[model samples]
Target chain A: MIEVEGLTKFYGAFPAIQELSFNARPGEIVGFLGPNGAGKTTTMRILAGYMPPTSGTARVAGFDVVDQSLEVRRRVGYLPETVPLYPEMSVFEYLTFMGSLRRVPELEDRVDEVLEQVAMLERSESYIGNLSKGLRQRVGLAQALLHKPEVLILDEPTIGLDPAQIIEVRRIIQELGRERTVLLSTHILPEAQQICGRVLIINRGKIVAEDSPGNLQAQLAGAERLVVAAGASCEQLLQLLGGLPGISSVRAGSRDGEVEVATVPGKDLRPLLARTIVEAGVDLMELRTSGLSLEEIFLQLTREENDEQAGG
Target chain B: MRNVWIIASREFRQYFISPIAYALATMLYLILGGIFFINVYFGLETGQITPDGRIVIGAMVTILLFATPAITMRLLADEYRMGTMELLLTAPVRDWELVVGKWLGAFGFMSVVLAVTWVYPLILHRMTSPGIDQGTLVAAYVGLLLMVAAMLAIGVFISALFRSPVAAFFVSLGVMLALWIVGSLASSSGTMGQLAGYLSFVDHYYNNFYLGVLDLGDAVYFLSLTALALFLGAQVVEARRWR
Candidate 1:
């Protein structure tokens, strides 16, 4: 539902984002994963029609973001990094004002629906200044969802929330992702992995990797490790496991009766190794696959990109 | 157009909800009331029952020179300070819509400020023996409204240039003072002096409208000045989108 091609934004002589391109499909929660100053906010602002890109183009729901900004704005909802709000206005008053500005039909009904969706219906009459940070963030979300746009662009939605509030906001985002295309940006690696269906790892204003969280974790590490516990001695199990066709290496695990077996890339040695262990008269207690965490994958990808740039 | 009205109404509502509007309105009425009472008292004591409103109009113009800045300082400056500009600019509304809406809001507030002083004319009508000229009074009030519109437009333009409302207030006050004093500063009769005299807002108001003269030239001058300032203010707002 969103397409950005050769999008470049420059502030004076310095480029904020250079030749960036990405897309978010319908009902897909695409996480823009990057560290601070990675140009994520710049890209989102361009997509939301807040500012035009210095060059190239971005289209949302098939409307040009620059030439057809009003149409693009009509079809997209944006929550800025700072969560822009008027503290003097109450929750319901703020939403009603935003609804009218967005030209939403039946604004009162839509306001109640959005307030309910964010679970903020009870505090609708309270002044925004009287609410906590988490509640204010919910009001921000309510405003974004008021018009029921096809696309939602959120920048650091869970930035300052406590752990529990983060989880709450994440749940709300996940629920919204089920019906609309959500393009959320965050420096928190776990947030991207936990909430986004697909992750776009952006570094230095460029996308270094893009895939599902599981796929990124598995593919970036190249080799898969397995922990096996059995009745046999460590030496005997190591010898037997190393001799298997696809087993690249075998070492004693940290546990008393466990062995760590490394498999070659794109190889499945579990069944063969199991059969060998069974025929050798060893009792197998446990066997499971071990994979790298998303944090490890992200750090490796960003570090590799940085090294490549430095070397080149 | 509907979007403009929506923004305007919201801004207008914001002004009324805050204490600043009430304070400013009360201060203005007291000042106008004091000037009206002193003028009426002195005129009646001198056996001239009809009180000419020129003195009150002169004082009103001088007071609005400072009051216009207070009313308009927060129009755009507060939006920047509070970071609401992001939400406002990112919406589907056009740049002109936001600018015109904000201008109308401040202008509407100034209307209320001007409306309360109508008691001055009413008192004059009731107490004066033969009564003041109704046509000239109406004409003078139109001139005052036009002057307020022009000054408020200039104040809005200045407000757009700064982020702090206090800074916007002081800078606009300085600009208005310069415009007010330009006529007196140019006492000689040369091309430069003539240009300065023509540019002076006080000269235009005192020489033409304060004496009950309804000159179309003066009307067009205030309107053109208002239009010019609003155009510049709109350009400033539009430039922000690019930066």
Candidate 2:
């Protein structure tokens, strides 16, 4: 439902996004995972027909964002990062105004439907300014869903909400994604892991990694580290485990009953190391594979990119 | 055009929802009324025969210098300041519609101001027994309406360049004053002065509309200026997508 090729946007000489290309299939929820200022907003704006990319092409629902921006806009629903809204306008009034701009037919009925969907029907008449941050965000989402566009490009949809509101918004997003193409940006790894079917990890405007959550971890983990708790002496434990095939290094932990094993990249030595350790007279207390957590992987990807830039 | 009306009506309603429209209308009525009262009072004391309502009508263009900025300063500035410009631009509406719709809304408010000022002439006719020629009122209204339309267009154009409504208001007032004064400045010079005088908004109003003559040239001047201003405003809105 969304296609992009070489999409780059430059604010004067500074390139916000450079030669970036990605796509979201119909009815797929693709998480745009990145930290703040990772060009997520810029890319979403271009896709939503809010702005034209300096170079390259983006199409929404098969309409070119630049050449057929109005058409693309008609088919896309976008919620910006800040959720900028007219505070003086009531929730219903704001939605009606936006729906009318799209020339949506039977506008009031549609407005009510979306308001209910976002769980804001009761407060539809309240002034947007008087509503709390969570309610205002719901109203913002209501406006985006007012016209029932086929594709949703939400930039930080769950931002600035309390914990409960965040879960409610995510549940709503997960439901919405079941029938529409969703490209949502967020810095929260768990948010992406919980809801996004596929994750596109972006850093500094480039797609550093893109895969399913489980697949992404396996790809980045490369080599597995094993933590072993055993009855052997620290030096003896290290020496016993050191000569095993594919064993790169072995280090003793702070306690006498703990040791850690490192292996060659792309190899899982857990089974072989376990068999070797069990055969030996050393009584093993515990043994488990230690893979990098999602948080660590996220940091490592962004941090690695930063280091590469600094080193250059 | 449908989109333009949708946007325009929302803006017009916004004026009433806020206190700006009521305040502006009250201020215009009080200032114009005061000018009329002083004209009659001073004329009676100085032994001047005529307390012309036409002069009071002419003075409106000046008051609108401040009034136009107030009406227009927030039209575009608030959009940028509050970040609603992204919402408006992302909709299916075109750039020209956004600019023209806003200018039309401001013009609608100014028209009501023009209509209310008709009471001044009505008062004059009642007191002086057909004091100012009624036919002249039509020509005067035409001139003032056209001039208001042009000034509002200029104000809309200026508002687009700013995110600060206060800055837009002051700059708009300054630009209107400079344009209003350029005609008097023309008295000092020669050929260029004639051209400069043509740029003055008052000259276009004072020579034709203020005198009760609905000259086609002056009407064209205001119309063309209105078109030019709205065109520039549309261009500014369009430029944002590129920038």
Candidate 3:
């Protein structure tokens, strides 16, 4: 568990994270969502005891981060954005060194265990510099897990990986969430949606929104979208859908020999529209009704935050 | 202490694998060899390279000035450049353990370099029929070793202050040169000056050990200086982590 109160960080005159406060309970995977320069890295560094907070305080497992840093460091495993590693060292050597730094009992055995867990046991002898980006990340994860700390703070853990590698890292992270506290920061919106139980959206060094994915979607409820494809011209489709009951607005696009129609808010007009389109002798290719995906929700949150700041 | 040993061993292992360790060692011994052979073969006419305490002492201290920075500069700079400092600083190991371990590792490297240079004296022995007096040779080697140990510590201390290897090298070299010069100048000035001269690494080697005397005061001076450097290195690292 962790507690943070009015945490602020200033790099000279510039504020990195300002008056930020949040708590993470045990066994929860909280996603830190933000755009670049949003202070996610700064916040994580403060929690990891790597950087001092400008004002306020953060506590990990009941110990003040600044006052009881050694204890806090012992309790948290931090993976920085760049995945710091010694190029000259083999994977096994790096993990062993990390284990000893944590003063882990049976360090060799612990190193093997983490290597196996990360699916890196076979590549233990490979020099870190020679490893591909994915394997290098795996090694970084292995080092963080070697100490078996209570909390894991990973910053952009899956950045720069291919799609498959991203999925692998995400699986490992989701597994890690079951038993340990996880605070993952990423700019990738869908990544947060898949693994995080709760989301904290930040912009301009401040927390703008915090909620579950479903709750966030529900907050913007009644914003239903309809994507339709018909044989009619785009303008004609837009005109017809635009005047329908319960429809807010309509836009027109075309692809694959069909006019693509976008209808705002209110739907189930699909059944009525199908009959009308058939009677009107217009071909219907596809019709679907859906709310915003998580990506849209994220952009909306950040855009709203930006708008509020600009308006003020 | 166990943690210190762990850190120290890892550092030593890294030095062995890296090119810097061999490069420094090779350069040191070659320079020492050149100075030793040149003084004996060429300086004999002018009595400049006589095997007296002064000539041997000068060679030892000069070798140290050339060699100490190579071992010490990379100690902290490489860690910063490689980003491994985060891994070390965030670990549970205390700041003192990290500092002392790294200092000892660089010191151990200096010892190995000195050990290799021993072959030079052996070569000199084989060349001469009766060979140089063993007692004076032993004293000269001891003085060189102690001076290097103290200078290596100073290098480690200065390295902790900067994340740049070039900067660390220049800063450490500047400090060592200033100290050595101060020690020599003090003796000619007055009584107080003479006392300062006694603290000079050059004076300690030339006046004491080079003369075939293993003075306890000289030995203690080097040991105390090593301790002071390592302590300051530890303090600098700790303060930086806090900031």
The model with the greatest DockQ is 2
1 or 2, which is superior by lDDT? 2
Scoring each candidate complex against the real one, what DockQ results?
0.72, 0.80, 0.59
DockQ class, candidate 1: medium
Proportion of native contacts present in model 2: 0.87
User: lDDT of all predictions, in order shown?
Assistant: 0.87, 0.88, 0.81
Of the two candidates 1 and 2, the one with more favorable TM-score, higher being better, is 2
User: Which docking category, incorrect, acceptable, medium or high, applies to candidate 2?
Assistant: high
Across residues A15-124, which tens digit of lDDT does each residue of candidate 1 receive? 88888888889899999998888899989988988889999889999999999999999999999998989999999999999999988899898898998888899999
Model 1 error, position A142 (Å): 1.3
Q: Indicate the DockQ of the complex predicted as candidate 3.
A: 0.59
Say what the interface RMSD of candidate 3 is.
Answer: 1.7
Clashing residue pairs, candidate 2? none
Q: For model 2 chain B, where is the 10-residue window of minimal lDDT?
A: B49-58
- Give candidate 2 regions above 4 Å deviation: A230-236, A239-249, A253-256, A262-287, B38-51
Every model's Cα RMSD, please?
2.9, 2.7, 3.9
Sorting all predicted structures by TM-score, with the top scorer first, yields 2, 1, 3
TM-score of each: 0.91, 0.93, 0.87
